[model samples]
Target: METKNINIPAHGSNVLRADIPAEYKWHVQDIYADEAAWQAACAEFKALLPQLEALKGSITSAQGLYNALHLQDKMSQMLDKLYAYPRLQQDADNTDQHLQAIAGEAEALAAAFSSANSFIEPEMLGLGKEKVAAMLAELPELAEYKFYVENLLRITDHILSADKEAIFAQSRLATGTAASAFRSLVSADMEFPPITDGEGKPAIVSEGNYMLNMTSPDRELRKNSFRGLMGTYHKYRNTLATTLTGSARTAYFYASVHNYKDTLESCLAEDNIPTSLYDGLIQTVHDNFAPLHEYIQLKKDVLGYDEFHPYDLYMPLSKAADSFACTFPEACAKVEEALAPLGEDYIATLHKGLTEGWIDIYENKGKRSGAYSWGVYGVHPFVLLNYQQRYSSISTLAHEMGHALHSYYSSMNQTYVNSEYTIFCAEVASTTNENLLLEYTLQRANDEQKIYLLNQFLEAVRTTVYRQVQFAEFEKFIHGEITAGRSLQAEKLENYWLESNRQYYGPALTVDQELASEWSRIPHFYTPFYVYKYATGYSAATAFSSAILSGAPDAVEKYLGFLKAGGSDYSLNILKNAGVDLNTPQPVTVTLQKFA
Candidate 1:
């Protein structure tokens, strides 16, 4: 109970959106000139709904299918614009009621539109694959939809009868109850006990600020925050285990109902990713635990700690040094230099977005907490960030900008149907930019900054690559248990979590009991089998980063091809064209060596 004064920043009194400078805020107007314009567009779109219904029965003919597909594409493009504007507006100031209503209207209309067009996929599949291909061959205008149509046909086995599909869709509401309970328990109902911060004032630990405290230089603060945070979760262990078990059961049910062999197969089949890709990543990371152990040992040595624990993992090795912070303009300049290898056109587009209010740069009251790059078709991408001027924040700026530029390229080059990239490729673009920033900064860093940068890079690998795989393994274990007809009771979950952590953390470190309770708090468990993509994506980025840095022939062009390639190809194949093969262990091996 140390009670020394802590100089925590003040909460409350959030700055109004109107009070923020125009340049520092996101340009929501780019989506629509005003609310009145948005209303008119919504009306026009609503009136055009009958046109889609008109083509419902006539899609049997090639020309008719082409017309329907073309019309759907046009409607989607406008619908995206209509939805993106208010959604972004609501995010900017979540406390505003007007924006909330606008967002609701936009979402409801989009959902209705989706329901209205749900017949297209089933009808198109009913026409059979050969007929669809022949129609595609006959209609040049629908050629852009070849891959889309092919994918729908490829998954024809999984698409149930209309009545069965309707039942499954309705059951989704019930299937998701476990996830909803988990979310409610963690976010709304969970309470973290107050912990002492640096200088010893009482501070409350929360999800919003937990990472900040975890990364604090104050040892007691970090230790107490970890304890305080997990203590709350520990109390809910049994309840959470049940909820997680239910979620896993739900995944199994869906897999069984859909005729997939297992939960992992079902999830991968969505992106047309093979099970080998997932298994290869787990096997590779398991084989290469030495780099991770060595990095952990380095942290212990550098931090001068007698024993390393989970709480000690996030503190910077160069804790006594001043934190690196930059102004928004300065961050942009650093990112520009880092992204220099991506070609002038890429840089030019990024520069325009940076200056032209495409980014919401600062954190005021009620602004979004984390960061993301999002936009609909026909408009430039918008990034939401809480820029606090840290050196890592510069990397984050670069990461989101990478996503933004990827969207820019995809939207500019590909049709609306193919403009949105998959999450597998999306993470690659962002992490590639992060790697480039690390390399660029290292080139000019002094000894201290170099050590700091290396430490940061190692941290990135630890969290993104190693930690995510550990999570993936845990996910696999629980889902495997369910598929094998075993129950995921609290004790079973704790044991499995501890075993997974020990395997990754190695014999050099202690696997604390508190850490086993971590599975109770992870949200990804509800989504089952989604964490491995982070590991795979980061490995792919490392490979691409190395290629571009080594000046390999056509490397830049291949990498740019990756950015412009949206949903046109399967995720793994898209990376294959860019020269990184996830099916092999080389990317993971190369990334591990880089960590060394």
Candidate 2:
């Protein structure tokens, strides 16, 4: 536990609203070098809009289609570059009007693409499945476009008419505007309680520091932080519930209007994911409930408690005690050292991420809650963290930087249209690096660090794989109710969530009444049954990490291929190409057995 005083509150907006934060945030001068340069690029980006719209209806035959695809590719590349500048800049400073202007530029870009995307899908659907198949089989250049088109057509049944599509497209921004605003406000504005330490109340507890507080061996501090945190949440629960409810209803409404069966199918269609993959993850977790129970039992044994509490779950077992004694700075240094096994290039990239301002280390006022890795095309991935120098904080660096590296590779190799991979596979890259970092630590670390590493690894799996699966199951359970013509009331939701928690944790632990209100606590449920990937991806990543560590030939090559593949292929098939099959229940089963 190498302790270092990081000026977190000064770290500013780095943690808050970073999804829209491009990592390579240039200054106003850096972007334009002066007003003239920014203006010129803005004008150039604007010009592409009219040109792209004209090409949409003009392309029907092979040559025309080829030209259109080329144009689309070029346009996308330019937009990626153009958008990266302002958004990245804005993310760094919320008060910058120029950055806000750049952010506002997205509306126009999105609106322009609406016409083009609506045109391409319907036109391809009109070409019929036969034409699409023949084109894919014949032309290598057209292979990616064909896959894109085929998937578009596959969801054609869910698509509305041209007029409706345009309306749908335009409304996309407005539809989620309030919810998007709420997400920003909630994460950015919600106040956290200040924490009291032995001497005095030193830390101004924020979401970032809350985790560290929960792990404090000091029981009063831990309970104070946890209770203070939940108390803050309690004050805003109604506002949050309404905001989230509106978001969920909007999601539900859009799927229904689009002729889709449900929000789950609609989300899967958006990324070309199969529903079977989603269901398979849920079903796999269902079968592995025993392992989850066993983990809880082990956790109880490790904590020396016959009855488990939520806070005790994160506490170190007997051996891990020594590891936490190291200061926070020591942990950061070790993170760099432990991650050295990822090849020279990968290590340098991680180092670059650390040294470069790619990471905005520490918490600050109005910063977003939690951790995330984000960057646009043609930029190094930047991660925003409200970091406390704990062992888990180092683990977080490993996890988030994994995502940054993955995006760095993918965006470098693929065009923007295909560059963005789906969330299903997103979890793997991050978790795989985490797994690697942990293994490296256990091998090289001192006894304290080893126990710390072990505890950290277990917690990572528990959170990413088991807990996420549990959340996924609960999410789906509620959606199932919606499917069965049931309404989701707050009381009913609380009951359902607590019931699910009871089942997951087993009858051994006391289920606190406050935990029943946990349904309102999770922001991911508003994402429409989206938590399962954390489970599935971690499972797949665990296997991938094990394989790579075994000195398997081409392991790195295949792993790199998986990162670079992006949305060029569906996530599952891409993972198969990389190695790890989620279709069989084995991946999750194997991950569970590791706990044994």
Candidate 3:
């Protein structure tokens, strides 16, 4: 594959989607050649819904069980393709009403399929464990489904009746209302006032450029941007608080219905993660805040500030290398070179993904913000990136490609039923790539570049591990409040936010009032109990990257095995097999020590 020089557009440019070169866009056509083919596939998928419904009561025998699961898997794979095509189209340019409507239709189709197949679990559980065991023993083909069947049996106490299960599945479409409204308010409706840029000129602030403004070398811009963004959220604080509370209430409702102890337990139950692990993470971080506080003090002293504030957190310590930039091709080459420890095949596949249509590489007007890697089972994973010519964008490229390759390796090695890994394990692959990239870059840097790179690395740890754990702690608090029958009012939420920041950053930083409203802007809060995984993932990645970089025997192979293991087993078992255990606080402790 030949690499070409692809020039990235200036930051904040408004180029239209059509203007982006074809070579830079992901090939959604690979999923379906055109919309006509997508319609045909959708029709065929709808036609097979009744076949799945027909097998509802016939799962008594091993052959019947295998047949039902096989049909479900087939339709699932089809639906995945059906869903990815239009969704990818819409993500490319959300301003297209036609694409949006079709994406909605695909989403509804997915919901309908989920509702139709809701009976399988209840019906399977209706067969006693003894009977299921007997059926498995009787049929050889059931070997593939042994884990799926046993997992359902394992959660037998939580499995509802067929009618209730179907109702629950249907309710999912409505249950997302809170999250949907939150997204609309933050992404579409909310607006930030213009702030002074580092150049003493007017600059607009939006969700996309807010971080860019925060990292500006100009102290006034960072301060104004922080206030402008958070002040906007503060204005809508009541509504935002209601939406967050609604989500927490919804989580509490589901946990109660499922007979779980709390929302945290219910959220972690899907992957069978222990609640102790979550609590231990917070405890470990609480015990090890010295390094984080020390870093804060170091930054404050280096910046020559009388006092550090929330806005001062992201400024780089080294000003000399502040203008560092790289083009898209340069970023890709750097990522590929940085990832060479994974051996020839991994690098070769990564090169293919970079050159081929697997990546949509530039930002366009109405294009989705941020970066992600997503794909259907049979297709190569596709990455969506608003590639900017900065070191952070290069790091993001490495992070997202890590996810893509994880999905790639998993799909290549595992059956469809087991190919999708849990969110718990997903971040480990991405952050491992990030750690490796940072290490590789640091090794080859000059003194000034080393200062810049070290600043970036420490800041990544501060935000990814320390700051995320702060968010996780607050998340747990809100959910616990709801579980204990309290309202998540705006004032209470703000107070907790302020206090948590104070505690996490310590005496070096002054927690501003505007910073209190920061919680309202985090979209992750809508997805309850999700942020801690970022911290844990970073810690686990630190462990894996350290071992691999140290030339530990079999480390690369074991890490690759973890990626390929996918959802074949529980998340903890997979990480444990790869030689990092999150059950103990050792990984988190070691990560903090590294930061120190």
Give the TM-scores of the predictions, in the order they appear: 0.88, 0.87, 0.96
The stretch of ten residues in a row with the least summed lDDT in candidate 3 is 1-10
Alpha carbon deviation, residue 205, candidate 1 (Å): 3.7
Per-residue alpha-carbon lDDT of candidate 1 for residues 150-206, written as tens digits (9 for 90 to 100): 888889988766446545654665577797677556644676787887788987676
Tens-digit lDDT track for model 3 on 1-596? Answer: 23475455544435788787787889988899999999999889989988888888888788888888889899999999988999888778766779878887898888889888998888888989999899888998878788778777888988898989888888887787788778656655676787786677987766666677677788888888899989999999999999998899989988888889899998898888889899999999999898898999999999999989999999888864445576778788899999999989899989988888999887776666778899579999999888765788889999999999999999999999989999898899999999899899988888888899988889988999899999999988999899999989999999988988889998999899999999988888988899999999999999999999999999999999998987888888899999999888889898888889
A best-first ranking of the candidates according to their TM-score comes to: 3, 1, 2
How would the candidate models be sorted by lDDT, starting from the highest? Answer: 3, 1, 2
lDDT of each structure?
0.81, 0.69, 0.86
List, in order, the clash count of every candidate structure: 0, 14, 0
Please report the candidate that would top TM-score against the real structure: 3
lDDT of prediction 2: 0.69
Q: Write the per-residue lDDT of candidate 2 for residues 104-176, one digit (tens) a residue.
A: 7765676666766566566656677787677667667776576677667777788777667777777766766
- Candidate number of the best lDDT: 3
